[model samples]
Target: MKIGVVTFPGTLDDRDAARAVRLAGGEAVSLWHADTNLHKVDAVVLPGGFSYGDYLRCGAIAAQAPVMESIIKAAKGGLPVLGICNGFQVLVESHLLPGGLIRNEHQHFICRDQKLIVESNTTAWTNQFSLNEEITIPLKNGEGGYIATDETLKRLEGEGLITFRYKEVNPNGSMNDIAGLRNERGNVVGLMPHPEHAVEPGFGPDTKIAMRSGVDGLKFFTSVINSLVNA
Candidate 1:
C-alpha cells in the first residue's frame, strides 16, 4: 500500500513517519501542505511536530492547509487516516475527531515513554491490539491534554470510540486518560503519542532487552495493511 505523509512547515517528524511507513512494508509518499492533491495514496499519516509553530493555537493553522482539505474528504470516504501529536490537534481543529488538546495541566512540556492501553480494536489502525492490551510508546508534547464537554465525553466513552487510554500514569490531564480516539466510522484516528518514534527495534524506548526493544508501533501500520488485504 502507498501511504502519504503530509508535511507542513514546522512539521518535525514527517520524515520519520515516512520511514516508519517504509519499514512497515508500505510505500511512503511525501505530500506537501501547499498541494491540493494527495497523489492517490491508499492511506495518510499526519506526523507529529509544531505546524505553523503552533501559532494562534496548536494545529489551528495547519488544519486549514490545502492538503488537509483533501485529507478530510478522503478520510470521510473511508480512506484510513492516522494523526499523531500536532496531527491530532489538526484533526480536532478540522473537526475530523472530537475534543481539543490543550496545554498540559501542569503547564509544562512533558516527554517520556508512556504506557497506553489499547481500549478499542474496532479502528482501522488498532486491529492488532486486544482490547485493554498495554503497550508503551514515546510521548512528547507541550499541549497534549485532551478535553471535551461532559456530554461529549460521556458519548465517546459510551460509544467505545476511545482508542487508547493512559496506563500506569496519566502524563497529561487528559480526561479519562484518553491517549487516542477514532472517528465513528473507525477509519480516521487521532493520537497524542509518538508511535513513529517507537517503530525501530533497537532505537525505540528502553524495554526488556538491551539494545533490542521490539517495535510495538509497527502493529498499527501493519494492521492497516492487513485490513486492506482482508477487505
Candidate 2:
C-alpha cells in the first residue's frame, strides 16, 4: 500500500510520518500542501506541524490550502484520512471532523508521553488495536483541547465515533479525555498525538515494548495497509 504524507509549509513531522509508513512496509509518497493530486496513494496522513506558522489558528490557515480542497472531497467519498496534532486541527477546520480544538485549559504548551485507550477499533486507522487497549504515544501541543457542542458530543458518543481516549490523565483537558475521534463513516480520523514518533524501535514511549523495541505506533500504519488489502 502507498500512503501519502502531506507536507504543508512549516510542517515539522512529514518526514517522520513518511518514515513510519516505510517502516510499516508501505511506500511513502510525498504530498505537497499546494498540490491537489494525491498521486494515487491508498491513504493519507496529515502530519503534525505549525502550518502557516499557526498565524490565524493552529490549522485554520492550512485548512484553506489547495490540497485540502481535494482532500475534503476525497474524504467524503470514503478515502482514508488520518490527521495528527496540528493536522487534527486542520481536519476540524476543514469540517472533515466535528468539534474544535482550543487552547489547553492551563494555557501552556504540553509535551509528554501520553497513555491512550483504544476506544473504538472499527475505524480504518485503529483496527489493529483491541477495544479498551492502552498504548502510549507522544503528545505535544498548545491548543489541543477538544470541544464540541453538547449535541455533537452526545451524537459522537452515541454513535461510537470516539476512537481514542486519554488514559490515566487527560493531557490537555479534551472533553471526556478524547484523545482522538473518527468520522461517521469511520474513514477519517483526527487525533492530537504524535504516533509517528513511536513507530521505530528504541525511540518510542517508555512502555514494555517501547522500552525493549520501539514499535507501538507501527500498528497504526499497518492497520491502514491491512484495511486496504481487505477492501
lDDT of 2 by residue, 54-128 (tens): 998889999999999998999999899999999999999999999999999999999999888999898889999
Compared with the true structure, all predictions reach lDDT values of 0.91, 0.91
Candidate 2 stretches greater than 4 Å from native: 209-213
Which runs in model 1 stand beyond 4 Å of their true positions? 209-212
Error of 2 at 103 (Å): 0.7
Q: Candidate 2, which ten residues in sequence have the lowest lDDT sum?
A: 208-217
Give Cα distance to truth, residue 163, candidate 2, Å.
0.6
What TM-score number comes out for model 1?
0.97
